[model samples]
Target chain A: MKIAVLSGKGGTGKTLLSVNMAVIGENTTYIDCDVEEPNGHLFLKPKEVIKEKVAVKIPVVDMGLCNGCQKCVEFCKFNALAYINNKLMVFDNICHSCGGCVLVCPEKALTEKDKIIGEVQKGVSQGINVLSGILNIGEASGIPIIDKLLGEEPKNSQKTIIDCPPGSACIVMESIKDADYCVLIAEPTVFGVHNLSMVYELVKLFNKPHSVILNKCLDGKNPAEEFCIENNIKILDKIPFDSELGTLNSNALIAARESPKYKKMFSEIFKKIIEEAQHEAAVNP
Target chain B: MKIAIPVNDKSLENGVCQSFGRAPYFLIHDIESKENTFLNNSAALSRGGAGVKAAQMIADNEVDALLTPRCGDNAAGILKVAKIKLYKTEGDSIEDNIKAFNEGKLSPLMDIHPGLHDHGGR
Candidate 1:
């Protein structure tokens, strides 16, 4: 079973819950799809790391081989190409790697070349396989890296935990495309409620079975929890606003690994996730 | 002899559009002829790289210079390659900026924004 954990807003304890669940869940592989700024490796601290570069095809114009038709420039929907000073100027950062420009060029001036956008790191941490996608700075998008990270997973092997990037963009959609169950992490602020609704709508649109994990729970009225209740979304668990966990997390320590209480709590959550996923599959499939 | 200014509307009475890439219309004015033509900015609704597309449109129109409040780096690069000079507008008035350009009163737009990518997402 594959479970994707995501949140609309950043710094909402997505890493905390996912990292802990991966540690406590047996036969699990943790894959971090937050290629822009993946921090799961800092907590996992995997050993014997293996790195693989991920690249995408971008158009390279051969000035000598062509006539100035302006076809490639007009063909690009992203406007990644332009005709300037009687030469075709290709913006590598703006290209979406659709390869339409290359195909549209009748003069054969455009050719594709591999541009390294990011890499995937695979390693083992405490018997759990940890994988992370890291995108190079100044890159347009991280979807390609996320694709590579999730595509390389061993088929039908064991429990896979996907730590998705923040928000309901294309990158997040790509991360949760193959997930059996989705866990939406949310906070207690009004801003948190707004963001939670965004992801909730996204999951519903994708038709993925999902539940909410309310993080940083306080004694007062919790907006995030209220949202889940109003929407009839099940609450998987609630991680309280505690300083012990905060200090450990700030010091780059996994709470589940350092504290037995956290380990026990996460184990129960993992069990609930497994049961929910199984129930969903039996009913839907 | 020909210059361009991003405008909110086709009329010269309207103020200049704050955003060059997403502007609704561009007023191309020929200094020697004193004739003005407002070309609709088709790149206004582009999903991404609107500035680049807009710059390409300006270049294709054969404008010698551009009078605007600001421009993005990608658009600036295209204009630089097209040999189109960028002049910073003095105020929101499109007609005034055009006059300022003819009188050599406008300064070069030195600072180019990094572009607001995914503004509503965060």
Candidate 2:
């Protein structure tokens, strides 16, 4: 079964939950889908076995054989082309490399070129295989890198745990789209509940079964729990606010190793996810 | 003969320079023709980073010059490659800024702020 852990806001322990869950699953493959700022390797400490450069198609304009009729500029839907003094200007960033500009160019001045935007790293940590894609620091769009990472998924694996980036943006949706089930990690604060609702809506749009995991559940009362109850969503588990867990997390230490108290907690969460996936399968069958 | 000034509405009006939440409007004006095109910055305003996307817009738009208070290093390098001139805007008003640019009154920015990443080699 493939399980994805996602949150709407950053610093909500999405990586923490993902890493711990992978550790507890034993023999699971961990796919870090957060291509922008992949922090999973810091915790997993994987031995990178292979690294591949990821490239995007950009436009390359030749000035020599050009009529510069501005047809390429007119054909570009992204506004990635311009004509100046009978010269064709190609904007590499805005060029979606759709080849529309090239096709419409009267002089055949436009051609496609490869621009390195990011890299994909495949490694192994303990018993689990790890794969992560890192977007080059200045690259704005991460969807292409995410697509490359998903394409590199190992063919044979007992269970795959996907670590999705924060928010309900296109990148996050793409990462969690094919998951058997999704684990929405949220805190009990108002902000957490609000973002959780946003992610829940995204999951609902995909028609995927999802459950909430309230990390750092507030003492005495849980606002997320109430929200979940009102919305008729099941609360998977509640991990109490633990100071030591927070400290270890900051220092890039695995929670299951640093705090023995949380090993059973993660194991319990893993078992529940498996049970839920099975239940989903049974219902569908 | 037109210069493009990429700025958020707040920076164009208040003169309060902020690192984030800049508007996505280009103040384009022809120096000789006196024609103006306030083109909306379709890419940079919507996207977060001020790197490849910004550079591409300037290059592809055939913008002769850029007028802004500051720029990240990656953006500067990309613009340099695209042969777009970078200048720092002095006045607060969009009209005054364009006038200054047309009269060759604005100063070229000497220092490029090191963005989250430096593209020195490329």
Candidate 3:
């Protein structure tokens, strides 16, 4: 079963929950799709076994093929090409690697060159395999790195958990697209509720069956519970704000609060996710 | 020599458009012919990088100078590369700015403001 953990707003503990699940779950492949900043390794402390660079194809102008039709400039949908003073300039950082520019050049002056944007790191820790993508700074797109991580032929595990980037933009959507189910982490505040609904709308748009997990909760009624009740979404679990857990959280360690309590908690949550996926599979099949 | 000015309307009697990228119309004035031809600023409707597209459009027109209140850094870089001189309006009226341009009374523009484009998603 493939599961994606995503949140609309940052600092809501998406990584925390993802790493915790990775520790407690067995035969799991943990893929951190948060290429912009993947911190899951901090918690899982996976021993690096494989490392590989990922690149995207960006257009390179030959400057010699001898025609200046400006067709390549017009064909670039991302506006990565600039023609100034009879010279072709490329701001390749923004290039989406569509290859349309090369195809449109009448004189075949434009060619594609591989540019390293990011890299995918693979490791193993505590029986769980970890794969994370690291994006180069100042780069506009991390989707290429995430794409490679997802598309790579991998050691198939019984369960796959994707740690998605924050926000409901293309990055988050692309990360969560292939998941069998999504676990949305939400806090319980006015802003949290607003962002929750926003990400919930995204999940609904993707038609992904999902459950909400409340993070850093106090004891009583909260907006997340209320919204879930009204929306008929299930509350898989809640992790109360404990000072000890906060210490562990800061150290990038998961579910060390009372060992057994948190371990049992994550195990149960992982089981619930599988059960939902199974139910959905039965219904669709 | 030619000069490009962002105008609110196609007519030379109109006022200058406050926006550079989203300007409604542009007047390309030929210094020798003393003729003014108007081109619709299609960059106004660009989904992204309107300033850069507008700069490209201006460069394509083969104008020697650009007259506007402001230009974004990205567009200004393009204009600079194309060797297009940047200038500011002496007054709001297109007629007055043209007169100022002829007398060289308009000041050169250096700094630019943020371009108007919706950040599609955060």
The sequence of per-residue lDDT tens digits that candidate 2 reaches over residues A160-227 is 88999989988898898789898888888888889989998999898888899888976677777888
Output the number of the lDDT-best candidate.
1
User: Each prediction's DockQ?
Assistant: 0.51, 0.14, 0.29
Give Cα-based local distance difference scores for all models.
0.91, 0.76, 0.84
* Docking category of candidate 1: medium
**Candidate 2 chain B: minimum summed lDDT over ten consecutive residues — where?**
B14-23
**Candidate 1 vs 3: which has more DockQ:** 1
**Cα error, candidate 3, residue A215 (Å):** 2.1
Ten contiguous residues minimizing lDDT sum, candidate 3 chain A: A251-260
User: For model 3, how does the per-residue alpha-carbon lDDT over A1-285 read when each residue is reduced to its tens digit?
Assistant: 788999888889888888888777778889999988889888888895698999899888888883777887777766677788888877665577888998888888888889998899999987889999999875668888988988862656878889999999889888988889899999988788888898999999999988999988998879887888999988988878778777878877777333887788778877887898789878975
Q: Which ranges of candidate 3 are over 4 A from the true structure? A: A219-221, B5-39, B67-74, B87-122
Between prediction 2 and prediction 3, which has the larger DockQ? 3
lDDT of 1 by residue, A84-191 (tens): 888888887778899998898898888899999989999999988899999887677899999999888867548999999999999999999999999999999999
Tell me the number of clashing residue pairs for each predicted model. 0, 1, 0
**Could you tell me which residue pairs clash in candidate 2?**
B8-B23
